[model samples]
Target chain A: MTERGLLIVLSGPSGVGKGTVRKAIFESEGTDFEYSISMTTRNMREGEVEGVDYFFRTREEFEELIAAGQMLEYAEYAGNYYGTPLTYVNDTLDQGKDVFLEIEVQGAMKVKEKVADGVFIFLTPPDLTELKSRIVGRGTDELSVIEERMEIAKAEIDMMSHYDYAVVNDKVELAVDRIKEIINSEHLRVARVIHRYIKMIKEL
Target chain B: MTERGLLIVLSGPSGVGKGTVRKAIFESEGTDFEYSISMTTRNMREGEVEGVDYFFRTREEFEELIAAGQMLEYAEYAGNYYGTPLTYVNDTLDQGKDVFLEIEVQGAMKVKEKVADGVFIFLTPPDLTELKSRIVGRGTDELSVIEERMEIAKAEIDMMSHYDYAVVNDKVELAVDRIKEIINSEHLRVARVIHRYIKMIKEL
Candidate 1:
């Protein structure tokens, strides 16, 4: 039997360019990873693709998924529901495709409780100054909101210890390369091949 | 301060071309790994460098090292003492140069006890048939001895579970590339970078 693909959970502090790195990796050649689409009650923004950006759902529909334990992890953010659908990820992994989940730290923690073997990677900016500049550079948040985000970023960076790997988002391409190397190297982990070898040994 | 270099322990069953791969990696451009020179009481063979191949020593000198805990791991083979000198490995790592220790599975296990965080990699052939052919190709052993070696290879392959990674030495360059990726990716592990980030976070 083929080994199951790695469940890669990519998370980082806000404004750390996690989304940019994820996009580059999926777009790059030789990466066969499936993006785990999240279910969200938020309205689709301009240029957002249905079922690609997110699986848009009504509040009651999301509530039903949560009640049935179908959502791997979910949260109510800004009066809207957002969650990862369990079936999509499980199906993709069952087909031997690596599934990438780009979630916030809190949702990642919840996902960890459900999938203990997931590869948890924390992406970070080179420094807090860079992170702050990126937050300010967004041009969408107010001064007070940016300050709050900086505080949250500090707390999130402290949680890097909980992750299996950390990739600094100094450059988007470099970060993507590091993540790709990490994914390739992890596939060579002896633990992943031990059971297969054991069966082969017994037959021998 | 520069991060301490990764202590890379490479082990595999005999006839798996572990030595060939190690030499190729050191010869490759941009690889700056230091080989951990072993101390041995055996007389130097023709063309072997005194400090490079093995630190040729008298039995008394070798014993002194073992007594003073200077030897990381050691074994007696064919009435001669052979061992890894602890100072060489620790000093190399302290200078931020990766140290490569190529030894048998038993010695690798011993070194793991002393250095709990070392990256242990097990190299193997593509399959048992290939392993058997390689063993026979050596041309020095009798039929019985060859059978004995095949049995040992099976036992050693079972120990792959204890290693952090396994690279099939199907092709020398491919094995080296996988190992390089493992080392590069390991440096990005969160556990390795957490303390540095923690200090930076404190200042921020």
Candidate 2:
């Protein structure tokens, strides 16, 4: 039996740029991990691919999965359904390939409860002040919207206690390095080693 | 407002080179951290300092600290008293300096109970076979002594689940980087960040 791969949960406030950093990690260290494509009812936004960026699904199908307990964690937001597909994540991890789930703090908490053994890492800007600047710099939102996000950021920070670790997105490369380090460190863990040992003996 | 430093506990089986790695970290990173020198009744082993290396004390004094709850954790191994002093660690952390206690697994566990807020990182060799080779390669020892050490190592691996993280001592640079990442990743934590804010505001 192969030692199972780690299930990584990435969460933070909306404007913390977890998406950009994760994208950078995928583009560069793509071989290190596979991203978990969430199932959602939202329409294809801009350059998103159907099965790549997200597993675009109809409301009826999503509800079916939800009702069947096939959704690890789901929440309806902004008039659309979004959730982690339990089957794909469980299958990928069972195959011994590390997987990533980019999610919100609330959803991350929910997923963590369902998958109690999963690792949760919260990504954040260098500080709250920087987070405010980044949200404003996005330029798509009004000042009031940014202020609203700042409140949400506060709630996000408060919810961070649920996370196992946190990485600051000071620089993409550095953050990615830390993220990779975390994954590597987890592999060296004692439990995993013993699990590998038991299988090694069985094969011997 | 300055963020409070994390209370970190470093532990591993003997001959894992935890002390050597810790010394290298101090040399490279300088003294921004509080190296909690444990108190002991063990005889002065060559160039060891009284307070710097350890707090050399009488057996009676060691018992006194234990009775007073001044010691975080301790053990009597090889007929000598060895333990971590609680006051210095708490004081240094209160002053916003990161504290590192290089301890055995038992002592590390005790610190964990007191400071569950602390980060615990266990250091280990890549594999049990490698650990055997490393122990024998340390010096010319009898095969039985090597076997005894291996048994102890196996026990440590058994208790590895008690640790929060593990760093593989495959290479010096890699181990150092992982340990530093553990420290840095901890700073991004919301509990520590919010505590810093509260403490800073209280000062004003």
Candidate 3:
């Protein structure tokens, strides 16, 4: 039987560049993980493919999945539901293909509750000042909103204690390299790969 | 206070190329670990630097150190003493510099008993058949000796359960890369690094 693959979850506080870092990882030439497409109840935007962008579903369908416990983790934001489909993630992992999930901190926590063995990586900023600057650099939010975001970011950073690894997103490429290394080493861990060696010795 | 650096131990059964792989790692441009120079009572060979090659010591000095519990691990071989000095390893780590020890399987076990947190990596050949060929390829051992070595190797391979990682030495460069990745990932482990983030959050 093929060994199951790792479930890697990339998450962080708002404006920590989780999306940007995830994009860089997927765009890199060496990434072998299967990006898990999230299911959302939001309308499809312009130039967005049906499955490529997201598995867009109607609000009723999304709630039905949630009610039936088919979603690995889901959250309601601005009256819309966003979640990871449990079936796809489990199926991909069982086929020995790593699954990559990029989500919000709250959603990631929910995933942690169900999949205790998943590699939960908290992408942090260099410092709180830098994180505040990144939030303000967006130039869209008002001062009050930015301040609220900073407060939320502080709380989320506190939640980093629950993560398996805390990678500082000083640069996208560097963060991606660290995450890749973590995955490679996790595969080599004795708990994960020792069974094969034990079998080899038995055969010998 | 600086975080204590990890004590990385690379070991394997006979004919597994542990020395070659360790040498490649140390010679690599990015190696930052301090190679723990072992102290031996054997005579210094020609062209060998006193401290660089091995810390040459008289048998009396070696015995005194061993009696004082200064030797991290030691063994008597060919009527000579060879062992790692605990003072150097502890001082280097206290300075926040990593110490890399490449030794035999038995020696690694002894080190493990003393340094419980050390990263013990077991380097293995691709297969038993390949391992046998490598041992016989030496051309100096008799058939009976080769058979005896093979039996010893099997027992050592069984000790892999005590290690943190088991890397297959299929190619030296690939094995080195894997070891590097292991070290990188080990540095990012939440248990080892979360305190820094906790301090950061407190300051924020």
Candidate 4:
């Protein structure tokens, strides 16, 4: 039997460039991971393909899936539901295809509770100084605003304890490389691959 | 303070090319790991450097170190004592330079007991059939000898459970790449790197 593929969850605090890093990873050559498209009740935008941009679903269909416990994790915004389909993720993994999820920290924590075996990676900024500068660099020089942003960032960074690996988003390319290394090494982990050897020994 | 470097122990069954893989790793550019130079009581041959080749020591010195618990692991072969020096390994790691030890399965296990945090990697052939072919290819086709060799190989493969990673030495370059990935990913592991972030948080 083929080994199940990894469920890779990439998350970080707001403004840490999780989306940029995820885009770089997917665009890089030799990345065979299947991006887990969200099933959304929102209408498809211009130039958006059916399954490419998002798995566009009617509100009734999306709520039915949610009611049936088919959504891995879901959130409603502006009266629309967005979620990862549990069946698609499991089916793809069963077929030995890795599924990559790029979500916010709170959403990632919810997924962690459900998919305990998923590889949770926290993409952190180089340092709080850098993160602070990024926040200040966003044209907001207000001291209280900066302090509040830093406070939120710290809380999210504190959540890193729940992650298995932390990749510093110092450089997009470097973060992508480190994430790739994590995936490769995770595949070679003894716990994940030992069953094959055990089976081989039994056959011998 | 610099984070202590990892103790990477690479071992496998006999004839699994541990030496070859280790050599390839050191020869590869960007490999900054320091190979742990063993201390031996054997006389230095011509053109052998004192510290680079081996830490040449008299039998008395070796015995004193062993008795003093300065020897990490040791064994006598052909009346010559050979062992890893505990002091050197600790000093190098304390200086934030990784120490790579390429040894046999028995020596690896000993190191595991002494240094529980060491990254133990077991290199194995692609499969038992390939391993058997390698034995037969050695021109030792005697049924009894072949069976004995297979049994030994099986026993060594079973030791893989104690290792953090199992790399199949299917090709020298591929094995080298996988080992590099393991080291890179290990450095990113949350357990090894979270302290820095904790410190960063405190400073913030």
DockQ by candidate, in order: 0.80, 0.26, 0.73, 0.72
DockQ head-to-head 2 vs 4, winner: 4
lDDT of candidate 1 over B1-204, digit per residue (tens): 878998999899888988789888888887778988777899997888898777899999889988999888997754788789888888889998889988778778888888889999999888877887888888777899888877888888888888999898999999999999898899999888899899878987
| Model 3 per-residue lDDT tens digits across residues B1-204 | 899999999999888998689889998877789999878888987778887767999999999998999989987654677789999999999999999998778778899999998989999999988988988897787899888877878888999999999899999999999999999888887878888988888887
- Best candidate (score: DockQ): 1
Q: Each prediction's Cα RMSD?
A: 2.2, 4.6, 2.7, 3.9
Better of 1 and 3 by TM-score: 1
After TM-score superposition, what is the CA distance of residue B192 in candidate 1 from its true location, in Å? 1.1
| Model 1 misplaced stretches (Cα beyond 4 Å) | B41-50, B56-61, B77-80
Candidate 2 C-alpha error for residue A114, in Å? 2.4
**Per-model CA lDDT versus the true structure:** 0.87, 0.77, 0.88, 0.86
Candidate 3 Cα deviation (angstroms), residue B148:
3.0
In model 3 chain B, which range of ten residues has the least summed lDDT?
B74-83
TM-scores, one per candidate: 0.93, 0.78, 0.90, 0.85
- Which candidate has the highest lDDT of all? 3
| Highest TM-score scorer | 1
What is the C-alpha local distance difference test score of candidate 3?
A: 0.88
